[model samples]
Target: MPRYARSERQALADLFQTLGPDAPTLNDGWTTRDLAAHLVLRERRPDAAGGIALPPLRGYAERVRLRIAARPWPSLVDQVRRPPAWSPVSNPLTDELANTMEFFVHHEDVRRGRPDWLPRDLPAGLHRALWKRATALARVMLRRFPADVLIQAPEYGELSAGRGGEPVRVVGPPGELALFLTGRQRAARVQVDGPALLADRLRAARLGI
Candidate 1:
């Protein structure tokens, strides 16, 4: 199988080097340097990574991330480029399952963050991979949404999410659907169909892991 996790990791690292430290990303206030630090911290310091999803641990995680972010730019990007072989998340055995959606999303974060951005022509195989990941992600991220949610990647697959209510259908390619479900709704080019108010709410909802 193709190693998308490894490829995306390397591509993101190259993009960081090309854009330099100050470039923006779709991740709210995070710049390229900040994103690089987050990646490095996630892979290198698993102890601090938990704070990403737990409010109680976030302060410590942020502190550690800031320190990592403060490293010289080349050093920080290098860390992002080369994850530790023994890290639980990025080791060869687990890297694909863990980092495919991660690096893909963050790669688009930086790509779509720019004013002159255009979508890439992704390979069909990668599209299949992303569709698989996106379906699983939508199941988790949209589980508690107010309306019944149907996510479709026309050429790949579809899946349902949300609790239950009036039905809403989101139609787009897998990668864009992934972006929408991950809180980049404004930046993702996808179609939403349902009651106006409910659909609008779905778009505005805070999403992602």
Candidate 2:
């Protein structure tokens, strides 16, 4: 099987290096440098990683992130490309589970941020992998949403999500769907079918893992 995580890691690192520190990313307030710094801290700083999940710890995490972001851009990108082996999320055993989607999403965040961007043709297996995770993530992020969310990736599979209401079918390939539901609705390419008002509302609603 192809190693999606590492490929995405390298791809994102290369893009960050190519774009330089000031380039815009789909991440609302982040630039290429900010994104690279986050990736480095995510794997290298265990103590601060929890801040990503816990509201109170966010202050500490931001402090560390800012400190890291101030480093030379090349160094930050290198750290993202080659995480130390001892890091909890970088070792082979946990890498796929920890970083596959993490890197994939962030990679697209940079890719789609550019005006001339085009979606890449992802591998079939990787599409399946992304769709499987997207299903699980949808259950979490859209659990309270006001519509019955149907995620459709034509060649892969389909699944339902959200609290039931007017059924909303979100159509796209797996990778795009993953991006859409993961708080990148603006950057993702997808078709929403349902009541127009409800569909519009759905698009405006919060999504992502």
Candidate 3:
């Protein structure tokens, strides 16, 4: 079974619990409260504001707490099924999968500075799924980066630029590779071996995140 939903939720909840009083910074200067609000709003009003909605920052923390308390396990699957109530926004499976991947990745984001926040265990199945999603997203994002570079991580097989500089090698288990590419975790289980310069460039870009 695809355990992305449950595992992702567990990870996020654990991260929140671990973070406690200190608010961690997320992408684009958003605080932990902002990140939590964004995640909750996205799940609640997926269609708000062209698939993007911004709630008031003042009460966001409490809102997030309440929202998290109210949500049930099957909410994500239901959200995936229906059209986002917000117009001009669509939730493709790719987007849904990507969101699931983001949840897992961002869990690490909040925990990065706090050592005690690290997850004790990550579900193997969910990790594999995220890796696959990361591979696909990496291919899409590679166009923005140099083609000469290659990423070799055991979690995500060997990804290399193909002819005309398109990413052609997206071979690997989805979860591990996805986490490595995104910078959530180091490529410990896997190794990137090819074009040192390219590898450095890829690392700099942080495509997996």
Candidate 3 segments exceeding 4 Å error: 25-28, 47-99, 115-121, 149-156, 162-176, 183-196, 206-209
lDDT of 1 by residue, 1-209 (tens): 79988899899999999999999999989999989999988999989999988999999999999999999999998889989999999998999989988999999999999999999888888888889888888889888898899898887988889998999999998889879988999999999999999999999998986
TM-score of 1: 0.98
Residue-level lDDT tens digits of model 2 in 1-209:
68999999999989988889999999899999888888888899999989988999999999999999999988888899998889999898899888888999999999988899998999988888888888888889888888898989998888888899789999999899889888888788999999999888878877763
Q: What is the C-alpha lDDT of each candidate?
A: 0.92, 0.89, 0.51
Among the numbered candidates, top TM-score falls to 1
Clashing residue pairs in candidate 2 are 181-208, 182-208
The per-prediction CA RMSD against the true structure, in angstroms, equals 0.8, 1.1, 7.5
Model 3 lDDT vs. the true structure?
0.51
Global lDDT of model 1: 0.92
lDDT of 3 by residue, 105-187 (tens): 66656665444443336556665566566657666666466564354435535554423453322233455456556654343
Model 2: worst 10 consecutive residues (lDDT sum): 200-209
TM-score of each: 0.98, 0.96, 0.58
Candidate with top lDDT is 1
**Model 2 regions lying over 4 Å from their true place:** none
Models sorted by lDDT, best on top = 1, 2, 3
> Candidate 1 at residue 109, lDDT?
99
